[model samples]
Target: MLLRDKFCLITGASKGIGKAISEIFAKEGAIIIATGRDLESLNLMVSDLPVYSAPHLVFKMDVTKEEDVLRVFNELSQNKIFIHCIVNNAGIMEDATLQMVKTDLIHKIYNTNVLGTILPSQNAIKHFLRNRCGSIINLSSIIGTKGNLGQSIYGSSKSAIIGFTKSLSKELAPLNIRVNAIAPGFIDTDMIKGMDQKFYEKNLKAIGMRRLGKPEDVAKVALFLASDLSEYVTGQIIGVDGGMII
Candidate 1:
């Protein structure tokens, strides 16, 4: 229970990696503020977590909406729950080649992936700065570090997130808050389900482990970054890619 009684806010926590992280955080004795767009699934997660009773709070939110985010934060603040860590994990992937991309899709992906990240980070920082002690973990992807065909839009958004994390770390270092990014490769989630066969196989073959990453792999890194174990680590990008970057 390295993070006993800590309050963690995780975005996109209805299913997949987000939900997995929430459960892991809870089992580590952290109270979770889990946000997701699907109310039913969110409720299920709140009930499914392994922690003791009342360790989780679920908020139905669309990460792209500033108003929704603001309202949820306000509600949490009013309840007097201090946020100790924030995980920015909400993202949407819409892939198309440079020439084949639509203006509308580009805007949609950026709103959900980029702006979705920026707004919550800004909001969370307010709470973090108040305590002068907190951690912000941005969920980036290996695509941001290396390009793949038809991944221009998705990669760009994630790249922006990683870039933002680095810059934000410098800005908030004096406040005693750490900011970092985790670049995960081909995790077994629906996000990877859409990857072209050739692209997925090429990446898997490149991995020294000869396997795809799991949500728990990323969740473990995130837990370390969120806890005091990473007190000296900040403003960096770590890959949970099974040595693919090697």
Candidate 2:
């Protein structure tokens, strides 16, 4: 049990990669705090988590809203729940060409992807600084690194995450806190399922493994970062893209 008794807060935990990370962390003996915008889906997800001595908890958290993020953190403090790590997995993807992008759409994407990550991290980092130990695992994307045809806004937002991860890692490493980011490739999630069949097949051919990566694949890497296995690692951008970039 790599994370026995550890408390892990995973955002956007109702589906896809976030849900997979929450389940895997629970199976590894971590007490899970699963949060998302949808209370019902979050509840459903928590109900199925692997049981442990400390039952998994669920909260409706809109990571983009400062009030929502603060309220949850406050409640955790009130309950004396000290999290060992926080996975900033709450994010959204809206694709459009530069000319087709609207100002409102830009705000929407940045609000969810950029500010969404920062608010939770700001709260988590405060807690980590006080404890002198914690892990911050952020989700970036391979699209952010290798430019895609129709993902300028999404790519820039994820790229911001990579910058945040590196800067924060350096700032807190001296205090014994770690921060890192995972840039996953075209994962087989709702985001990818809606892709045109031709585009999907093209991606498969581009991937060295000739297959789309699974949510579990990203979750497994997340587990390593959350656990002691990555105690010495920080300020790194880990690519979970199955050799797609190589």
Candidate 3:
């Protein structure tokens, strides 16, 4: 019960890492607020969450839209529900070499991966500032630190997240709010399944553990960061990459 009675708001919560976070948080006794653009998938996920004392909620939200983000938070505020933690996990990735990259693709990546994180975060911090304490867990990527062959735009977007997490952690520390980013590497998710087998196998060899990570691996770290275990930690980019960079 590491997060008993805590209210955690997670974006892109329909599947993959976000869904895993929601499930783990629920099991830990947190009231989950799962949100995503896919209404059907989100609803299905809500139904599958482990039963806990506090009820969980699912919202069809587009994190990139300011109005949608504001609406959800405003409704929560009106209901007197305070979010204890926010996992900015909503993101998109499309790979292409720099020469082959299209401007529209770059825009699509930044809009969802960058601005999507910023909008909800702006709303969440207001709540945190008022409460005088909160945790902001952002999703960065190992690719952001170590550039990938065909992920120039995606890497740049995640790089922005890393910078955002570091600067905000410093700014919010005095207010008792903690901010950190988790950079996951080659997690076995539907997203990763789309990669070519040759490239995937190459990545596996590069990993110290010689295997791809699981969503649960990232979820466990997220749980730690969201709970008191990481109360003293902030402004850090923790890599869940099986020592890939090391």
| Selected candidate, larger TM-score, 1 vs 3 | 3
Q: What tens-digit string does per-residue lDDT give for candidate 1 at 13-75?
A: 987789888989998888888898998988888897777545688898888999999998899
Predicted candidate 2 versus true structure: per-residue lDDT over 60-154, tens digit per residue: 99988999999999999888888889999999988889999999999999999999999998898767766679999999999877878889999
Collision count for each candidate, in order: 0, 0, 0
lDDT (Cα atoms) of all candidates against the true structure: 0.88, 0.91, 0.92
Model 1 regions more than 4 Å off: none
Compared to the true structure, candidate 3 yields what TM-score? 0.97
Tens digit of lDDT per residue, candidate 3, span 103-197?
A: 99988899999999889988998888767799999999999888888898999999999999999999999988999999999899988778888
Who is ahead in lDDT, 1 or 2?
2
Global lDDT of model 2: 0.91
Output the lDDT of residue 246, model 1.
24
